[model samples]
Target chain A: MTTMPSFDQWMKAVQAEMEDALLRHLPATQQIPVRLHEAMHYAVLDGGKRVRPLLVHAAGALFDADARELQRAAAAVEMIHAYSLVHDDMPCMDDDALRRGKPTVHVQYDEACALLVGDALQSQAFDVLSSGNLPPERQLAMVRLLAQASGSLGMCGGQAIDLDSVGLQLTLEELERMHQLKTGALLRVSVLLGALAGKALNDDETAALDAYAAATGLAFQVVDDVLDATADSATLGKTAGKDAADNKPTYVSILGLEQSRALAEQLCVDAHRALQPFGEKARRLRELADLIVQRKA
Target chain B: MTTMPSFDQWMKAVQAEMEDALLRHLPATQQIPVRLHEAMHYAVLDGGKRVRPLLVHAAGALFDADARELQRAAAAVEMIHAYSLVHDDMPCMDDDALRRGKPTVHVQYDEACALLVGDALQSQAFDVLSSGNLPPERQLAMVRLLAQASGSLGMCGGQAIDLDSVGLQLTLEELERMHQLKTGALLRVSVLLGALAGKALNDDETAALDAYAAATGLAFQVVDDVLDATADSATLGKTAGKDAADNKPTYVSILGLEQSRALAEQLCVDAHRALQPFGEKARRLRELADLIVQRKA
Candidate 1:
């Protein structure tokens, strides 16, 4: 039997790969506005676990895709994530003073600078995708997928719902719907983009990956909710109890701690089953899904 | 000689063409988020002169390009303009309560909604370009052009400078540099995209179009500054005299009123001369430059 790679080792390898990829793609262009580039580099290079980019790279590696090709896709996804966090922390939105244990963009810079940085980063995501060395058809598909995942029907739309529903008791279904759009959409896109970056997948394989992404995406959120409830600031790397302090709706809030944990475990199992067709090719993805649910931070 | 179209008649023609073109392209797809569509419609259909779209159409017509094929390009440019305006009006930005006498997006809905709408609109501009009937290479080129024009080096960058430089006295050169990126980038893109939408232009024609766009764009801003200083709210259709009130830098602020007016007239003449090769074929463009500098409102 093949020995399982240590989770820490795998994460470290992927993080290095992702960092190299991001740096390779984000060359300082004389034409790019200097301040804009500074802000983008500031937010993107700010330390965080390279989880989304790792998922992308791991999924691509499962199919024996080119590592360098997958790197651009990975960087693009991470850029989107960074941009979302920047905007989410704005005064008008979540009003987060801290992110990843550091002052949030708006707090670190003025609100207007933070806002423009987020806007620039968001636009840069599409810019990188469209301008990167991808075929036109693939570029078009990637743009469309990222747009759907980031726009109203995806991340931004989910944010609107979250803003509207803040401080209100939400049903389990409503919470799931919100999380699906807010987090699940981009997470699924991460996997979908990886598959697209690799060789084309048959309908069955695509469906299986979709199922896996869907389950794991929700499981990731459940774990986040659980951590938010249980973990302290140092461990979580952000304000631990802000959700509850703000009276925000969460899976744990709606389903109780035990129930939420149970749901997460169930989803992880479903995710593993979804990867069954890929056999050993998807072993890393399976482990990643489990790690997501089991994560304490 | 064909009687020159009256200004009102010309505007009505452009408005009808813009509406028809937008509707033709905006298919009723269930997949598209309804709220996004509503926001796009709200901003696009909000009354304005449609000058950007007009410039696209007129520039294409000068090359005898198919009017039908140019519609998508026209709509795409307008959408970018509209989205920029929405974001520019946010509380953290210009904080304008009204745009063209109607409540700004943030005032009409909320800051979150307005931000999302702007994001959607910006992404949708790319979507239209990518999914339109243009060749893949052409679409890719258009996407790059639009991204560069709308991105940090272009409109957004311009806005950032404007925000940062507020209340500080600016030199004429500095002011011109700001407007070049802000308004002139899109204006140049308007004409270049028109040429790209038509049969591709040779280097000479492309260079001339750039010159035309730059001169006319600067003239447009000079006239705007002049109007802000002299016009009333009723005629301007939005807050007037607010620029001087805020101590915002403008051409009239940096140069005296007479010098500013002289600069605008000189730019208009340069704009007309840039189209000399096309001559009467660009009569409408020449008329537009004159009208922009001479308009009371």
Candidate 2:
């Protein structure tokens, strides 16, 4: 048999697929409120690592899920991520001027358009996921899962905690809890939804996948904190050292750079261990875990 | 048989039920990001006419739909409405200080909190609808319908047109098209979703309901423009005449007050005519059309 494609090859292909799918799913910029649609396209296209969609594709591959359905789920999750970024970078939130190595949505567009883009993107995400090749029941589950993941109890809740924790010292437990809800929830859901787009996993298999997702999710945040501290803005594609500048609590702030790096590595190890049951089928997931903890930006 | 409740009594009951359902659906303030939850509660509760919910209940009553399912649908639509109002009143949008006769969300809370409240409330609305007593497929349909109604093609799109049209002259057709998507889309969905919570309607019945919703929806906006010109801020429970102040085009601006009032009456008549198929079952809806056209606030 031919050798398996490298992780980089896999990522390149999936990224292309995701970009195309997102373009197809987004309203044409020529539509009414052309500016809003243009802003939405600007916010989502030609930007950022498609990490969420990659995780979705990687997990779905094991089950040989329907490709079209997988694309819908992948697009939906990435849309959520994009909308969150758009809103988070608003003047009322992080107030960042740059993202994905370009002007942020609110900076390139106006604040009102940024706000509407976020809102419209979110509604479109749900709209895309609600109807696809999947069974109606499964689609409903996807909607419920995504709604919960993005809502107050998940990413939004985590954001609230993050905002409140600013300028305040947070314990390791508190920081992890906040990250778990904020980034971790959506990341985990990405994997689960990817898996869901295919054959239903047995309870044990789903549990293992959930464990892998949770560990890698946290690891992703830990590395993010480390990068925010260590990387330059050009390399990171976002404002560097923003956490420290804003007095926001981060892993590096609480544990220092060296210890935070160690923690990310440990979490990656935990993520890999959680995938032991899947063995070779989870090779991609394993590679992703390593990539998350070791990326330069 | 006991006489059916009067329109006033029916309104009182549905309003109370909707209030209770909204409270039940909102996140408890004890949760983390308590402030966001508090703001969400403040934005939704003890405010507004609950007109959307009333329409939902009235339409559901026609089909003898499940009360619990209808309650969820009603609450979801109202939550969407509330969130839109919150976002629209933000500094970047309308910059209004009063809504529903009290401080707007951005005024009561900070702009950031107001933003988050709108986002979270929207998520919660979908969450509430996704797992209600209805079948999974129906729930999926509700999710899809609401998503379409609220997304860029609908309310958000209309708002964008509104924002863009400021200081620009929009023809009567363009203004009508904008209102159809903005207010009309949600109003139509409110009735459609309520009817959907019960047995599905045949095409003719669905078409009739859609026409009723469309006409009544436009009539609602027409009356709103008239009231905005005639009523004071205190009486209107919002910053009245702000449409003129902002130089936004309206029915009053395009058709003149007399013509607009005439249009409202004509639409009300059309709404009543569309309900003949439902006969006495549509009495509440018939009363609602009259109430909507005649209400001062």
Q: Over the stretch A24-107, how does candidate 1's per-residue lDDT look in tens digits?
A: 655363544566667767778847887788788768867787777678778878888898898888877778887788888878
lDDT of 2 by residue, A187-240 (tens): 998999988898766899889999999999999999999888888999998899
Tell me the lDDT of model 1 at A78.
87
Pairs that collide in candidate 2 are none
What's the CA error at residue B134 for candidate 1, in Å? Answer: 0.8
Q: What clash pairs does model 1 have? A: none
After superposition on all C-alphas, the RMSD of every candidate to the true structure, in Å, is 3.0, 1.1
Which candidate achieves the best DockQ against the true structure? 2
Model 2 lDDT, residue B223, Cα: 99
Model 1 CA deviation exceeding 4 Å by range:
A1-7, A24-34, B1-11, B20-40, B63-69, B279-283
Model 1: fraction of the reference interface contacts it also forms: 0.41
- Residue-level lDDT of model 2, residues B1-297, one tens digit each, is 998889999999999888899999888989877888888899999998999999998899788999999999999999999999999999999999988789998998898888888888888888888878677777888899999999999999988888889999999999999999889999999999989998777899899999999999999999999999999998998989999999999999888999999999999999999999999989999999999999999
Each prediction's TM-score versus the true structure: 0.92, 0.98
